[model samples]
Target: MEPGTARIAVDLLGGDDAPAVVVDGALRAVRADPDLHLLLVGPTEVAAAVTDALTPVQRARITVRPVHAAAGPAHHAPRADSTVRAAVAAVRDGTADALVSAGSTGATVSAAALGFGRWDDVRHPALVATLPAVSGPVVLLDVGGSLEPRPATLARHALLGAAYAAVAHAVAAPRVGLLSVGTEAGKGDRPRKAADPLLAAATLPCGARYVGLVEGYDLSIGARADVVVTDGFTGNVLLKAIEGAYAMAGGPPEIGGAPRAAALLGVAGTVVVCHGAAEPADVASGIALAAHLWRRRATDRVRALLAGAPAHSSPSDSIDTEVSP
Candidate 1:
């Protein structure tokens, strides 16, 4: 625990089982971090569930903003009055330093972008997920943020991932890699083939080098790359697959395991999104992650690194991956 007070606005109506898991998770987070203040956004009663469980001192730190509507689904357009949107607004208005949501991925991303403008260099906002691996922590990006990033976007994510590993996770001189069908030079599909050359040439900010191609195995073992870049679809699918394996194997290993929460990068503020079907512990982890990032000033450091990137390169490129609602 960092000593600063991190006011995190939590979406009480977000997630598969809204109000309950969110409430439970909020309570767990409050107990875990003494300096954490929560802006509970949802119905008054739902927010009470969290405050009611806290000690008198802890209860004093929570502020409630009543929002009745929760985002319906990925297909439905997020309403201005939705809890997720309100949480984002709290951050933009200086009421909160960060936000955590277990809502529809589409809704959360849209809300965050609308409230906190994206960085000038980041055309595609990336969702970065960290997995505990044998070697250490492996940073995977574009995990459902942008489904299909163009070759140029992949190249951008590679650099972004490398910076995130260095600044957020403290990986020194992180090794970057492109996720491909195989580790060979020309193994993946059309997009991977195209992105390969671009990533190889792209200059990473944190002394990171492109280590050619890496397979799915490399993500778990972390023997090849510290930061793995791929399309959101592939990264999202791969993250879930690794989590499923962890569940089947009893529990995550001691070194670390799959994280249910992901941090949204490219946005101006700190934001964490949890799995749609997240449990109480999962949502708590999301809140904790948000606090950690805020304390480290990771988002600002990443933006600074992006500004230091080459000015000649056009970071705005098109991608062809299909995004599922």
Candidate 2:
């Protein structure tokens, strides 16, 4: 809260390559931002690597919460007190302002929602990501929240995406779109068919307007919409597909393509989700995003905006779990 002194709790054992990549990312983030402090949550040894790699002055900025393990074999249920849970607890307990993890999407979301609580009426929280574009920045949401999709949820996400685009990216009047197979009026499957009208009817924040349905290419080019809303299942696959496309196209375009890092919306505290397959740079960007979010207080502002808006037209009862969170 001190201007730029953003304290972030990093999950040391949350990823496929836990400890190593997570440790490396922590080192990179620490070296890049002098004002950043990290609360490393995991085994004592893993935390030591991050602490030991830094200069004495840098090491002073880090704190470790060692999580001892049981003697028995671990079960599927997240260790009752693992690094990810500790990271979430740190945010909830005011030990840290935000958290960053390249962990299981569902585990992170569940832990954050349980620890910090969700905003009123947010049944299914969304994972939102921003992509830098030539013209400006674009906000995409429901990347991996829940799958299958309800018309109402998609519409609600449109509102979330618009506010994020305006607040985080500083776009004047974002043009929102529903991702589909084509830009035509009736170009997608059943869910898109139902959600298109819902989005059209929904009220958006920050002077955003719905631009109708857009295609996958639109996401890469950012030519159709500044805020693209979709179901978590489709959005997740689409984001990965775009990343793969860029890899095939000899790296992302100059402005960049789909991002591996996403912001968790609806939870009270700031949480960043990095792809399970993130590289050191991707993890660094995730840390930067968590810092930017905590510095801007994006979570609080977005919740405030949602509080002031009228109830969404769609029902909020169904919680789609297919999208992960």
lDDT on C-alpha atoms for all candidate structures = 0.89, 0.82
What is candidate 2's lDDT per residue for 229-258, written digit by digit as tens?
Answer: 988988888888878888898989887777
RMSD of 2: 3.3
Off by over 4 Å in 1: 311-325
lDDT of 2 at 8: 93
What are the models' TM-scores?
A: 0.94, 0.91
Q: Residue 95 in candidate 1 has what lDDT?
A: 96
RMSD of each: 2.3, 3.3
Overlapping backbone residue pairs in candidate 2 total: 1
